[model samples]
Target: MHKALRLTALAGLFMAAIAQAATPIDVYRDPNCGCCKSWIKYLEANGFSVNDHVEPNMSALKQRLGVAPRLASCHTAVIGGQFVEGHVPVAQIRDLEKHPELAGIAVPGMPAGSPGMQTGQVHQAYQVIGLTRDGADRVLASYPADSSL
Candidate 1:
């Protein structure tokens, strides 16, 4: 009986952890941009709960958010205290969610082969950038351009 009780308690703890592990995102983007909406939908499909805000001045928003010009994109997302820019992959977002110590991850620009911007036969190599609060950026990972995927 004690063993069963302990197992039940452990399972309850695991469930609570999973329930609290979900990432909440706040996205800022152009009001009429379809790609940004599609990206948000992709995030939603990947288990993120998004709060979206449409803004006319995405450039100003980026500036205010401290996103470097080189890392700028069509939309910006704040997730788990990190800033996610552009059409970053859902896996990368999940990585950021798992590692809360990093500042954020960004895709810089809209690469042709990104998740939401997949083209029929056009693909471009791109890097996901990890940013620091002091404006330092590092390449987190490089994803090959795979439009054929």
Candidate 2:
């Protein structure tokens, strides 16, 4: 009886953990962009839930979000209070969560090797940039171009 009770308690704790996890991120993307879909798939594969919206005016949205012209990407997401732009890797996303000091992160442009943008050929090296609401930018992570995967 004691062993069964302990197992039940453990299961309850596990369920509670899952229940307390973060909710689906609010995503804004153009309906006609396939790569944005791919990026969403990448997030889903990494255990993220996305509340997707087919944004009609991406340019205005990006501008309002303070995404600099040079740091442009295909999609935008809101997780917690921080923004995620482009095809940022799952690891970088988790890191951003860990460091709440950052206002947001971005992968900038559509790189060939990014999770959803992979074409199965050559991969392009890219940087995941951290951005502030005021337009400051810094490199959060750098991925070297490789096709080994």
For each candidate in turn, the TM-score is 0.77, 0.81
lDDT of each: 0.83, 0.85
Say which candidate scores most in lDDT: 2
lDDT of 2: 0.85
Q: Which ranges in model 1 have alpha carbons more than 4 Å from their true place?
A: 1-22, 97-101, 147-149
RMSD of candidate 1 to the truth, in angstroms, is 5.2
- Candidate 2 regions exceeding 4 Å error are 1-23, 147-149
For candidate 1, write residues 3-79 as lDDT tens digits: 99999999999988865775678999888888899898888878777899988898887887778888888899987
For candidate 2, lDDT tens digit of each residue in 86-116? 9988888877777676778999899898888
Clashing pairs in 2: none
